[model samples]
Target: MTTTNLSGLVAATYTPLNDEGDLNLRAIPSMVDHLLAQGIEGLYVCGSTGEGMSLTSDERRAVAEAYVQATAKRIPVIVQVGHNSVREASQLAKHAQAIGADVISATCPSYFKVSDVATLVQTMGEVASGAPELPFYYYHIPSLTGSAIDMGEFLLQAGDRIPNLVGLKYTDTKLFDFQHCLELQDGRFDVVWGCDEMLLGALATGARAGIGSTYNIAAPLYRRIIDAFATSNVEEARRWQSKSIELIRTIGKFPFHPAMKAILEMRGLKVGGCRLPQGRLSKADAASLRNELEVIGFDVEQAGGLAPAE
Candidate 1:
């Protein structure tokens, strides 16, 4: 979203569920500590990567509150309270603010299939109006929403009407569209590349932050990559980015949530397992992932290791 908190690396957290498919509020404090210890710049909770689409309204809000309390002001937590309903989004945003979240973001309403520019703008405006004081970002992933909003008008209107319109967690695969977003909103919005594949290209064009599912496993490496690049260590950054992408490709091979959880368990975090619908990673898949992880310098022991770059 807009404001000083929007810039830098914000990991879209994976919602950790308990065995009964309930929200795992207790696991958050250690998770937040893990991320903070790795130098993660920010966090986006209850978003797509966090399994927001699958959680009930109360479960999602509870997770948001847990995250806010767990983070304990160590870093910014951007709560994603988007839903298919406007009232739901408004209520969740209010919840996010009440829980002390640094920012609140929402995606365009999905399943309606209304692709017209007018309709898209109206939907975002309604959500923004609901949380008038909070900094908001358009969760622009055409892949999930089943409908696409025009960034040109959205960005333009966001600039004018929504004073707290901070940025977009861009998920549209096309760099041209992403670039157009940066160009149109140039100085006005801070773009956070939601997709892992586009991080380098996004960084090239001045994307201020990255909000990705993969960052849960690779935050330290990302921290290294971003720091290297910012300090003009272009070559080192290239090395880190290449390694990062290689690791991402491995995680991408499986359903992302379980794969991430598997990695955590392998590391001995005792983070527990993914609930059904998302399900557990198959045994074969886990082994293959284990191998892939080892290749990228991640080992069973290294998973929860404190070596920093080990």
Candidate 2:
């Protein structure tokens, strides 16, 4: 099996919208750098947490382009180009490659109850085949995709069917399957944790990385966890990884996407509020969030002034 340097213990951030509800494209690069600086080895460009399903195709393309240009070869950028439309997904994949995105990943298209398993596999297979030049990671989040299948079987078949397929983002809560996939597909694929809450457990398995939403705020914890483990500081890594999960509980309690945006807004980037149907944080909620950040040793006032590094 060919190797790809794409196991990403990454933070999936929301695309900030202005108060006017337009995407704050300008913030893309710095947010990218901030995560990388905080010791995120890699990042997933657009995911459910990114409001990817909420953005228009043109908006998605523009965001991907901005990330590519801003990073300027700084780190790997995995663009999430999955859409309900296969053609659109393929188009986004092609565009992502053209713009110099390092890897391409997509979740299973969730239109209905997933039709059948083969259809599910075939859909992603098409994407893998389409962007044969770039490595692809299959994203598994049954809650978001409404489909379930044997990940082990999928990877076994995927290896043969898709020449460039290299990884999996196991997001579902049932991690035994992820572990099984990790063991079964070991050396054939890189398995990244989709659920941030269980990152340490994922890391404990052969799985070495993650793609999570909460890392946007508490990236320091991620760094410590990985570094501690690298130095064989298992006890320290466990403590830090547990802290990472505990920190996420508060952020996770907040309707997730918007709360992350509010933190970014507090950081001085004008990423917008969630459009209608997605609510913004109330002032009281924002204040409480700030307080929580302080409890976690973050300086809210200082945070408001710093620009997220590009």
Candidate 3:
């Protein structure tokens, strides 16, 4: 099916939870407001950043609905429904469509590991079929999925098999492969860049949009990069991209997602810590992170236009 391509920054949002690790659905509205205020163009809910795999079917559905409702059609909300079980992922895709998600995306089953391109196509096709009416994007994050089939080949084959297949959230750092996907069939697929740090490289290779977690905490910085790139200010773009790498590296020192949630909390959103396996940031670590970010010139208010949480 034909669909409008996604452009600009789409935040792979964090799923808010309470102190007990239960879904804190109440926090989604303010999170959406905060991202929009920071100039995010779309919301990608239940993706890796949102701990989609860590959550159960019921919880994923709840999180998707909350984000979709809070966004209120002001921006597109692409729900990521990838699961180990293709059936479950498809069910989530159907639910996403039923709940009014703008698009549906899924990763190949990670546990069993998709063995080849054709198998990968069949797997994703099942998931995309669930939301037949909406555009479908294959979440091609091979690092996590361990299914490093040639994406260029996969697209060539899946294009006809998966009718709703629009493009990919190309996450790997292979610029050549990414460019191949972009130029495939006269750029038929709307391949969105997934690596936040390599966005400038992707742009040079013709990326029109990016879906990333850092955008939640630092959209303004990235927007400057986009603006500089668009204006052909190569030096300015590099400067901004370097700052983004610095910010990401600083957050990387701690538990990444937890540190991100802490930044959001510092900025006034009640986005609690991540679930187990990616646990919460300790108060001491949070304070230390604050100092580190300050040294890097990352003021939450200035960086994201958010007021400090009371």
Candidate whose TM-score is highest? 3
lDDT of the candidates, in the order given: 0.76, 0.75, 0.92
Considering summed lDDT, which 10 consecutive residues are worst modelled in model 3? 301-310
Give the winner by lDDT: 2 or 3.
3
Cα lDDT tens digits, model 1, 105-138, are 8987887765877676677777777667778888
Top lDDT model: 3
Q: Estimate TM-scores for all models.
A: 0.91, 0.90, 0.97
Model 3 lDDT tens row, 1-310: 4489999999999999998999999999989988898899999999999999999899999999999999999999999999999999999999999999999999999999998998999999999999999999999998999989999999999999998999999999999999999999999999999999999999999999999999998898889889999999988888888888888999999999999999999987888899889999999999999999888777865545322211
Q: Which stretches of candidate 1 lie over 4 Å from their true place?
A: 303-310
Q: What does each candidate score in C-alpha RMSD?
A: 2.8, 4.0, 3.0
Give me the runs in candidate 2 sitting further than 4 Å from their true place.
Answer: 1-3, 296-298, 301-310
Select the stronger candidate by TM-score from 1 and 2. Answer: 1
Lowest lDDT block of 10, candidate 2? 301-310
Output the TM-score of candidate 3. 0.97
